[model samples]
Target chain A: MTVTDEYLSNNADYAAEFSGPLPLPPSRNVAVLACMDARLDVYRILGLKDGEAHVIRNAGGVVTDDEIRSLAISQRLLGTKEIILIHHTDCGMLTFSDDDFKRGIQDEIGIKPTWSAEAFPDLEEDVRQSLRRIENNPFVTKTESLRGFVFDVATGKLNEVTAS
Target chain B: MTVTDEYLSNNADYAAEFSGPLPLPPSRNVAVLACMDARLDVYRILGLKDGEAHVIRNAGGVVTDDEIRSLAISQRLLGTKEIILIHHTDCGMLTFSDDDFKRGIQDEIGIKPTWSAEAFPDLEEDVRQSLRRIENNPFVTKTESLRGFVFDVATGKLNEVTAS
Candidate 1:
């Protein structure tokens, strides 16, 4: 079966126990920005309930312009006041460089994307950089409460990165 | 106490029960791109185990250039071969125009971001557009297997959007 079919069947099983119309605003008023890593279960890792937090994931959990746009909506339109940036150890983002990836894509697809992969060699530095990007953005309220964290995929440990 | 403090305490409780080291590549070979809406519990809804799927989420589940970058990593570096884009009804993305949001950010932050919020007027059309994006991108292999669905926020139902 296509994964869609399987997911639909599973969703039917889930809807039997489904509870909603959950509120538009997150109960905790927090938005989490993290990677799309399969190993990092954000809900289980952060102890978030179904309707407690907005979890935004992209590669590396970098605060891109698009991510900033989302955070803006999460803060201004929705009621999320706090921002949490979570990157992880052994992340796929740390494995490649922007130049190599762009060249590889060019070789494969005949298209050189203008966008950078936003890869970084140092994990904690990347987390700190993302934290600063959010903290410095004037549109994002509650800068005083910004925090960055790095999760170890192997041991399931999270270490907070203090602002440099 | 700050939300971070609460999360840290909860995480300690969770890590005590943690199981790992799950494989880097997803077990189901699928990458799911969905919204960051707090209401949708992607794993529970799709019956996904911890390491079965890579879940990429953002404001409206719109596929951005960065999303393409992440998907490239998911397929090229990791082993994922299928992609599912799930956009839900009553998205905050439908609540504003790009021009108005840009104006608001400019007024508040004195910096007009050169980015689109990727907002949509209709949810299904947006899903169709996102599906087409995945289908059209040369960087994303296995386009023949792409699927788009709209999850009903109130009913807990997901209806597949056949490409137009």
Candidate 2:
């Protein structure tokens, strides 16, 4: 997998941006909602252009209320016409509960996780729930095509989830 | 600075999930919406717990259409009550425009950084823009006290942005 020269520190270097541009994405504009797990190389996996897609990542990528609202605006206000929800295998989010994270905060840092009640019991369930949740979400435009997939971090493959 | 036993890996043994009890956050429940920068070990720097706060990360950490919608719901529905917007001293978001990232996608795995946006052009303006973006966000419940801070990733010190 080709890594962008820009890492966390040098990402801001406009000069180092992708010099070899590819044909714009399928939609030309897309919105990606995925997990924050460092393992997932969103740009590389999606073959996306930097400015082409607005990437939104959080734990689990469960398509919560916030995600739905974002999807709604993405198609309505932003140029995006497609929604790609990526939930991958072996995500840190799937490993713990809110309490586990909270204790990490209390015992360690004085601060707390900003939002809570965000707990995903299983990985496959997260994918199933996210699909069902986004498909029915009113925030997303009814006509807008909402699709999801489970990414295999090991295989670097993307497969459509027909049921979830 | 103690790191969790959890290893950030692709083959991360998530097998324990079913057999293991869910991890819980500490007594303090705080959530953070920060940029996804490895340099910023927010939990470690802040001494946070894994589950204590709901950490939501994204590109630019810009609270646009979906972010606002999510923020509103996050406050109204989710257990979180506090929100922290942490912008680092040297950020890549300012250095590269949407075009820069879009173009750089094929060659890289992630959008890394090199030069600080500090001298590129609009330094404080970028930070101010981010601060105002979050402050003016309609989704973040005004009922919930919102705070913004710019942390010097180098020094590990924080300074609250009161202007916006």
Q: Largest TM-score belongs to which candidate?
A: 1
List the lowest-lDDT window of 10 residues for candidate 1 chain B.
Answer: B136-145
Report clash pairs, candidate 1. Answer: none
Q: What is the DockQ for all candidates, taken in turn?
A: 0.70, 0.06
Off by over 4 Å in 1: A142-144
DockQ of 1: 0.70
Query: Compared with the true structure, what per-residue lDDT tens digits does model 1 show for residues A1-164?
Result: 87667878998888777767787778888899999988878988988987888999987899887788788888878888788889988788888889998898899878888888898999999998998888777767644367889987777878899889
Question: What local lDDT score does residue A52 receive in model 2, on the 0 to 100 scale?
Answer: 51
lDDT of each: 0.84, 0.50
The sequence of per-residue lDDT tens digits that candidate 2 reaches over residues B1-164 is 10111111211333222132223332233456665443444444454533355556554455544454445434433445666666665554555454453334323435333312122244445456656766765444433445666656545555566653
lDDT of 2 at B84: 68
Q: Report how far off residue B126 is in candidate 1 (Å).
A: 0.6
